[model samples]
Target: MKYSETINSLIRKGLNEVNHSINGHLPLSIRREILQTINEPCVIGKISISCALKVYPIWNDFFKNDTEIIGLIKQSEKFLLGQINEKELLGNAEHLEVFVQDYNKEDNIMVMFAGMTDVHAAYDVLTSGGMEECVSDEEALQNPDTWDTAFIASLAYNGGAVALDAINHDRNKEFWNWYLTDCIRIAFFNDKLPYPPTTSIVSAKYFSGNNIKEYRTQPNIWKENAECRSRMNDIKGILVKIMDITHWTKSDFYFYHVGTASYTQVFYYKGNELVKFNLDINISMYLSRKVEN
Candidate 1:
């Protein structure tokens, strides 16, 4: 289907922003080449179609003509605008079941799964365990809610991977490393913890685990340890300097699990009193690596 000039422009603008944000962290040489590749007319068509497929996976029906693709884009825009609810969004993602069949048959499953992971991760966070306590999509727009950590982390991973695909369809280790660091920072800022809890979050962990024991056994150890200090410094810089999430009013820190192997601790602060704390067990591996080194 031929989208109206206006609709086409809107879609382009929205996609450009996504591309630009993803490229911002890339090195100058790689970023320029990637932007050039993504800006190509043919590639844009594939990207648009891919994004549309994420929303409406009826391959035979949707891929038959441009009109169906246009409709898919419109549906996605509505979800973005908060005009549609989470129920509708998930329903649309379910269409991927059909979409995946063709993707796998064509040997493009890995590329497609990269995008699918984001949707599945978001779905898991919303429905799994205690994540339901996190805020809704509508609430997230106005304020940074605890759930935003999972939602955004999933997106960051997907976005980084997609951006890598655009460049050369190869995994870029540097981009992912930076992206993970940023996700941890953002999660910490939006944590929901109560102020002045009976026990300190960090202290409790120190007594319970060998991992924590290592850090606590040595005074100023994390500071003296280069790798540990670097990670801690990265987190501190993100919490104190980088993030602009001001909507979160709660003072809490809590551990949020993104997946089995990955988790993040979100620490929300109030006037420097350290009111809340979140520690993801996944971070223990990173710390463990540092301890070994």
Candidate 2:
């Protein structure tokens, strides 16, 4: 079951992941790794509420008189306490779904999406807990929701990125480091960030050989995407490829994001090996380094 395919499915999968984690069903980030240890809905509700509050300033600026949205959130909270029925809570979200059509697609789409999904993560996941599939970075980017802390934390980072982009459209690697680290800390670590468990090596016992499963760049799909065609890519083709074939996504071994110099490079870490690929054709021949285990 594709979680992001529909709101109900997303919620069901979210609930499922929290109950029994099989990996890949959650958001791409491992920050929510701890949530799997405890299958508590209230914790998710609390985190969702906090994320919404953190981004409230941005949402408020773009949308005033947000009564319906507020009601949806409040109803979500009520549902968590068993105060309201599922239909009542869902009715509220469904109503705002109509309004979000206008609120979305703006410059602050991430901001709005973060807030919208905030309500979703809180109320929907309380109902079910069964999801399907682990998508790679390419697919993960297209679908970013794990219906729990993994998702909420990821969206907080995404929304902040959009806001920062709106400001100056320039952010260095260090900023990314701080942002992701801080988000993980607040969400799972109780404001404590463990020094990254892995440094620079595919040789660590921490990773699997299949950390990066498949990667390829398809110009045909890029040309079909209006957003892709508009961007002035050197190759005029988008990098659309599967991530790790294992439980890990980029967020699992996500050390930090550093852009390649006039290049598009994708890195995947496996047990004691990190594979770097520069694609121009199919996935294998384009491998920058011979796969070593």
Candidate 3:
């Protein structure tokens, strides 16, 4: 299942509740409440997918290829949620940066998860622990930064990356393009950013050996070293950490886990030791989380 479906299904449920409460037509207040309930998740999902697609047009294209994801555009009703189409979302994000710059134009920007999966999942997780209620709309709106919106987006983005990796491995050039593009999108959206996005290599972990050397010169060193092993393990650790942190959204996260890379591996040689090492362990990440402002 795609992120869009998770959102659409949730909205339908909420709307159904509103519909059942009233006879023919809902009153303005009831309508407003219903719209509010539906809008946040829809907008969150749209912005997340749109922002992600901006970085990874291939991902957007993948969704375009996936009939279920593209189906959102076919809905007759219009809302902030449905407005995001795969193409427009993937369209020149760098170009769109100008508009955002003109709007809030502040370096001290924060991202909030508005999509259905993150918001609802986070709320459920939190509330299940015994909070008086799930995070209030007022609270989410008041401080989007504190909300787990990007955390949810992180799950979706990373989930897609894992799937694409498995389907074609590194051979899927299109998926790599999509992966890198989505990486850029997460960086931009989460960082509250504009671009031509600036990037500095945080770190590079490589995998290399006879098998890998045939692929590249100077050999990618992901495979055979204690250090590489350590780093790769670190990557795994981080992924699990994020997973544990977002356990509340586990079910939602699982939905997008399809078609993304969950872990990665590479071959490396250290001294006499020859081993297959994993680089970043085949997981997708929000670069912003790993970077410092």
Candidate 4:
């Protein structure tokens, strides 16, 4: 595609903004995000404005990253040019954006996680308001061995107590909460959400008759079926935020099954409509358990 003076200006502005944001120690993934956002409008087509109008969540969430700013400019370029193709101009939409791959060519992706802890003491003592049980005793015993960062973050914190402990450990609970805020994601640009009708199974049977014809029947299993859902989402113009933490253990070998607090959101143009989507998911992280050897 031909570049206009305006496009060039936008690109320059984007590069500068991104460079500063990275503080000159930019990683390749971030750099790609900046490039994709700045060039999206020029390459795709008004996706930016449309998304701003319909997907405020995405706009609000990703505004923290340089990619969002560049994406707006790129969308402006596409809108002005009127060069959208059939696939590009679907749904009478505005923005058509794509995600940035890493310098290593690894696609940008985020994972979910869950975490836990173990104690020689009873669960009550560990959770109760007894310093001797949960704090001092464990500390004096040098039993940092049982604290599972991911596990404690997921399950124990469900009741707010673990949250308290988390705050005490880092003393930066406020920062961590803000860090893991929810955001929506878009799968692709110029894509439309496909809505399908629900289905029902009127009758299901397991071969349980005693006759030779029905001989040796096994129980038939059934599961709740869900229709597939799809929509257009652009990853290029959005910022994905993820949280990372490494827990400490006292024993050389302690085991933990935990989840990490990380996620992603995207902005998209489906024809003329804009959309935002999010996923609050979980995954497991494992560490060897500490045992008296």
lDDT of 4 by residue, 87-180 (tens): 3332222221222112112110110001011111112111221122234323432443443222222222121122222112221222122112
* Clashes per candidate (backbone, < 3 Å): 11, 12, 35, 47
User: Candidate 2, which ten residues in sequence have the lowest lDDT sum?
Assistant: 252-261
TM-score for every candidate vs. truth?
0.24, 0.45, 0.20, 0.15
Instruction: Write one digit per residue (lDDT tens) for candidate 2, span 61-133.
Output: 4455555555565666667667988777777666666666565553445455646655654454455322333
> Which ten residues in a row are the worst by lDDT in model 4?
106-115
**True-structure RMSD for candidate 3:** 21.2
- The TM-score that candidate 2 achieves is 0.45
Which stretches of model 3 miss by more than 4 angstroms?
Answer: 1-64, 73-77, 81-149, 158-293
Model 4 earns a TM-score of: 0.15
Point to the candidate with the largest TM-score. 2
Provide the overall lDDT of each model, using Cα atoms, as 2-decimal numbers: 0.35, 0.41, 0.30, 0.24
At residue 223, give the lDDT of candidate 4: 21
The better-scoring model by TM-score among 1 and 3 is 1
TM-score of 1: 0.24
Error of 1 at 113 (Å): 1.8
